[model samples]
Structure formats: structure tokens, C-alpha cells
Target: MEIFNNITIVSSEILQEFEKLSSSVVSDAMDILNLEHGGCLPHTIRPLHNYTKTLVGPITTVYAPEGTSLPVHLAMATHVQNRVLVIATDNYKSCAFLGDIQAHLAALNGCKGIVLDGFVRDKDGSQGLDLPIYCTGTYPKRPGKADLGGINIPITIGNIEIQSGDILIADTDGIVIIPQAYASTILETAKKKDASDAERLKRVKEFNYNFASNIHDFTSILTKDVAEYIKKHM
Candidate 1:
């Protein structure tokens, strides 16, 4: 079941480290590095379930055509333990590419979750499984086995180039793809940002401020007045 022969596996320690960080924190770190477009996947993509827990894992990319399930099935058959399956459809919105059955198989194969840049069916079943699934939306129409796609290859979802081994951090905010090359550095920076954010939040709570001036740049006139009031009180 080794589909990607050249897959680069990230260590468990790194994955665990990323698990503690939120997508927003990682995105902020990426922005600080001037890699503005690195952390977000697409605005259309969203989590299927209401769970707010974050998903962090290396990705196994799958490029599938519209109304096809062969490539997805093949991806499920591969070594996917603790890995996130990223399915990039060719911007097809007609039929569902993945559903509960496939999600069950993915879970059995040790997949952490799935990010579909398309649609899926069996919403109830998928929700029952309690697996972390992020996608554009859901469709009632099922997919066909056309076998017209590739696995473990570079795919584009929302103009973001996703490759096998790239780390995916997804939560309620959205999905963030941290390229393998920049993962270590980004994680380090994100940790620092998370710490600073925690401290700032504590101060905000203590001072009962609507927003932290140091953390946020307020531009709106009303917000500016509020900031001034808070400053005067402090």
C-alpha cells in the first residue's frame, strides 16, 4: 500500500508540536516572514463537523478529476498513518468526490483527516464517524470510478501548490499548508507568537480592554476612539 515511494515523513515530535498551535498563529508567523500566501488554503474550504480541535499532519496529495473516485481510493490504500489526505479536484463542483465509506477507510488506514477542495456526500455518515473533514461543501450526488487522476503529486487548491510531505494545519479558522522546507522555522516562530499572544490575552483580560493596541492596528474611527479611551484609562 505504499503509493508514494518518495514520500518524506515528518517526525512525530514535529507533528505534536504543530498540534498545539492554531492556524491563525501559524498564518501570523508566515506573514511575519513575508510568506503571505503560505498558510491559508481557500476561503471556500471549511470543516464539516462542529469540532474545534485542530488537525496537524503531513499531507498525501491526491489530484482527482470531477466525478471520479479511483485516485482517492488509491490514496486511501497508501501508507497514511498520522497523515492528512489532501484531495484537489480540478475545480469541479458537479458531484461528490468523497464520502463516509472512504472516510472510514482513511481512518482505518491511520489518516488524521481529509481536506477536499471539492464536495462530498453522506454528511450524516461522515459526521457519525467524527473524523476531521474540511472541504468546500457537500453534495447529494455520488462520484464514479473513472480512474482518471494521480496520487502523491503536486496539486493546486485555491492557487496553493500542495505537495506530498507538506504539513497541513487546519482548524475552525481554515487550513494552512506549511511547506516541508519551511516547517521547522515556521513552527519555531509560531510558538513564539503563540506565547506572546497568550501573554497579551492575559493583559487584555486584566485591563478589560476591547482590543490590545500593541497586538492590533485599529484603523476605523470608532475603534480609534475606543483605543484612545482605553489608553487614557491605562
Candidate 2:
């Protein structure tokens, strides 16, 4: 699905709230709601470095170039503040598709962070940019003579499928791709899960789970309380 034209502006309060959530917890909450996993590569197998603030938005991907980088960059360069950049290589080539120079340019042009399926050159140079960069690896070779392959099109990185305008959320832990249609519901459910986890943590601290019971026979009571809480709040 295309990004909901009715983009919900993420507020400072919401962003701050997200900061308190572990990416794993958020993913687990998504699973609890039975949301699609979206797509992800093995974090251990990838050497991606995140440099931008954690935020979510529709994605826009670029394929390997067949010409100069400007054509694709200009085509995909957007003013969206929190959009995710997902660029895939044409052939899993060693040639770099993204680098610090392009990342800096994208940041200045108001694009969000980048997730390159291919290599990004100049890792050390990227330390100075405020933009987040996630890539397969770093290479000394800069993107060779732009437009060598192709912007704003669907592509896959590391075999993880991606489409333009799909919601993406990345943090220190890793990335989470949320289908566009599920954005609102996912966010709302996540709020509920966050509150529930907070309360459960409190209970665990106060009562200590080890002292509670062997099989934890209080499920019915807890379920009733949760139902009432949801009814009251939502």
C-alpha cells in the first residue's frame, strides 16, 4: 500500500515514549497482535550502522545505478522528514551504492535515514553526519560513476523484500518494517502493550514471580482486569 496520504505527524511526546521501548519488546508486541513481521535480515550477518534518530515512515528505494547517481538521487530525493531510504544493489556487487557524501546530501535535503542492501563507502567519514546509515558493509571504493544500474521503485536487500511507501522503524537494536495499512492499529496496540508491560513489571517487582505460584493460576483475574482496563481507556 502507498503511504497514507494522511500522514500522522509523530509528536515529541510519542517519540519520547518510543525511546522507552526496547525494539525487541516492540517486535514482540507486534507479534502479540499478530502483525506481519514485515521483513528483516540477520542482524549478526549484517554490518549496518544506524546514525539517525529512531523514527517511522514510508520507504522509498533505489536500485543499483546504470548512470550517474544524481538522476536516481534527484528522483528519490524527498523532503519527507522521517522517510526511510532502502536501496538495493543490482547484483550484490562489491561496488558501493551509498556513501557518506550521499547520506550527508540526503540529510541536508530532508530525507530520513538510509538502509542500503549493498555497501556504503566512507564509514569513518559518515561519523560526522547526523543521518543514520545501515548497510551490508563499508568499502573504500565510492559509488562508481553514478547511474550504473537505476529510484522510488521496489527492491530487496539481503533478500528482505521492500516496497516504496512501507513504514519503517529503526533503532539501535534493528529495523522493523510495518505494512502501511497496519500503521494506525499497530501504533495504538503498541501503546496498550507498553502500558501492560509497565504494570506487569511493577507487579513482578512487588510480588516477585518466584514467590507467586508454580503454574500462575491467576490468569483469569489478570485477564478480567486487562479487559476492564482496555474498556476504560480505549
Per-residue alpha-carbon lDDT of candidate 2 for residues 49-117, written as tens digits (9 for 90 to 100): 544457555676666644234434653455245666666564455566666667777878777677765
lDDT of each: 0.82, 0.59
Please tell me which predicted candidate would have the highest lDDT against the true structure: 1
lDDT (tens digit, per residue) of candidate 1 on 141-200: 888888577888888888788889999998888889998888888999999989988876
Candidate 2, which ten residues in sequence have the lowest lDDT sum?
A: 1-10
Could you tell me which 10 consecutive residues in candidate 1 have the lowest summed lDDT? Answer: 215-224
lDDT of 1: 0.82
Model 1, residue pairs in steric clash? none
RMSD to the native, candidate 2? Answer: 7.1
